[model samples]
Target: MSSDTKGALLDVVKGGVVSVTLFAAFLNLPVIGLPAAALTPFPALYFGLKRGNRAGIGLVLLAAVLVALAGGPEASVLYLGQSALLALALGWGVARGYSASRSIATAVLVTLGLAAAAAAVYSVASGVDLHERVVAGIRESISQALSLYEKRGIKGDELKPFRDALEQGGEVLSRLYPALLLIGQSIVAGINVMLLRRFANRLPAPIRIAPFNSFRNPDYLVWVAIAVGFSLLIDNNVVNAAALNVATVAGFLYFLQGLAIVRHYFETYSVPALLRYLFYAMLVMQAYLAIAVALLGLFDLWADFRRPRKPKNL
Candidate 1:
C-alpha cells in the first residue's frame, strides 16, 4: 500500500478508538464522567484543525458507527444527535479559522436551538408539558440520590432535612432550568473553544482570538437585557418565568465579562500569579463577592472600567 493510504487507514483507526473510549467512559462513569466525555470531540477537532472539515465529518460518522455497533441504533442516534453534532460544529469552526468567541457563540446558539426543537418535538409526541416532564425527571434523580445516600448510612434526622431541602431546590431549579441549560451549554462551548485554541496553537499557523482581558459582548445585548428586565414586571406567571430565564442567562454572560475585567486588571497591574489565583478562589468561596463582580461586568457598558488611565504631568 502507498504511504498516503496507510496514513488514512491509521487516522480512521485512531478516530474510532478515541470515539469509543470517550463515549464508553461517559456512559459508564455517570456523574463524574463528564470531563472525560467532553474529550469526545477532540479527535474530530484534531482532524478538522489539522486537515479539514471533510476529515472531521468522516471522523464524526465513524464515531456514530462505532457507537451504534456497541450500543444499538438508539444509542448511536443519541450520540449523533448530541456529541457528534457538537463535535462537528466545533471542528468546523476551528477549521474555518473563526475567532474563539465567535466559534463558542455559534456552537452554543446551535445547541440551544437544537435542544429547543427536541423539547418541542418530545412535548408534541408525548402530549405532555415539557417543563413539567423535566421537573419530574429532576425529582426522580433526586430520589435516586437520596436512596443511594441512605444505603451509604445517611438517614434519620440528618437525611430528612437534607432531603426536604433538596426537593425544594429541585423545584426551583426546574423553574430556572432554561437559564441553567443555556449556561451549561455556554460553559461546554467555552471549554471546547479553549481546548481547540490550545491545540491550534501548536500548529504552523494558529488561530487568533481577542485577549481574555478585552473580551466584551456587543452593545445590543444590554438593550435585550433591559427589555427582559421590563418584562419581569408583567403579571403573568408564564411571562415572569420566561423573563427570569432570559435574565439569568444574561447575568451569567455578565459574570463572564466581569471575570475578564478582573483578569485584565490583574494583568495590567502585573499581579503575581499566586495572588490572582487566590483572588479567584475567593470569588468561588464568596457568593457576595462573585455577585459584586458580575454586577461590575454588567455595569461596564457605561462604566468602561478598563479604560486606560491618563499620565500625570511632569
Candidate 2:
C-alpha cells in the first residue's frame, strides 16, 4: 500500500485508541476524570486537523463502537454528544480558516443543537419529560450527599437547615442547567481551540489564530445583556427563567473577555507567571472575584482598558 495511505490508517488507529483511553479515564478515575473528559475530544481534533475530515470521523466512530461494546448504546451516545461532535465541528471550522472564537462558537452550537435533538427524540420515544428527569437526578444526588452527612452524625435540627439549602440549590440548578450546559460546552470548545493553537504549526498547512489577550466579543452583545436584564423584571416564571439563562451565558462570555484584558495587562507589565497562576486560582475559588472580572470586561466597552485614549485635537 502507498505510504500516505498507511500513515492515514495508522493515525486512525492511534487517534481512536487515545480517544477511548481518555473516555475510560473519565469514567473510572474520580479525581482526574473530569479533566480527562474535557480532553476526550483532543485526539480526534488533532488527527482530523492533521489528516483530514474522514480520519477524524473514523476515529470518533471507532471510539464510540468501543465504548458501546464496553458500556452500552447509551454510553456511545454520551460519547458522541460530549466529544465526537465537538471534534468534528471544530475540525470543520479550523479547516475553513475560521477565527478561534468563530470556530469555538460553531462547534458549541452544533453540539448543543444535536444534543437537544437527541434529547427530544428520547423524550418522544419514552414519553418522559426530560426536565423532570433532570430535576429528579439533581435532587437524588443531593439526597445521597445528605444521607452521607447524616451518617457522619449530623441529625434532626442541624440537618434540616442543610437539607433546605441543598433542596433550594437543586431547584436553582434545575432551572439554570441549560445555561450551565452551554457554558460548559463552550469552555470545552475553547480549551480544545487553545490546545490546537499550540500545535497549529505542526499541521499540514499554516493556520492563524489571534492571541487570546486581544480577544473581544461583538459590541452588540451588550444590548442583549440589557434586554435580558429588563426581562428579569417581568413577573412570569418562564420569562425570568429564560432571562436568567441568557444572562448566565452572557456573563460567561464577558468573563472570558475580562480574562483577555487581564492577560493583556499581564503581558504589558510582564507580570510573573506565578502571580498569574495564583490570580486564576483565586478566580475559580472565589465567586465574587469572577463576577468582578466579568464586570471589568463589560465596562471595557467604554473604558477601552487595553487601548490608550486618542489625544483630543485642540
Say what the RMSD of model 2 is: 2.0
Q: Model 1: per-residue lDDT, tens digit, 160-190?
A: 9879988999978988988887787667667
Residue pairs with colliding backbones in model 1 are none
How does each model score on TM-score?
A: 0.88, 0.96
Which residue pairs in candidate 2 collide?
none
Candidate 1: misplaced stretches above 4 Å? 1-9, 126-128, 148-157, 204-206
CA lDDT of each candidate?
A: 0.79, 0.92
Whole-structure CA lDDT of model 1 = 0.79
- Each prediction's number of clashing residue pairs: 0, 0
Question: Over the stretch 98-158, how does candidate 2's per-residue lDDT look in tens digits?
Answer: 9989999999999999889988998999999999999999989999989999999998999
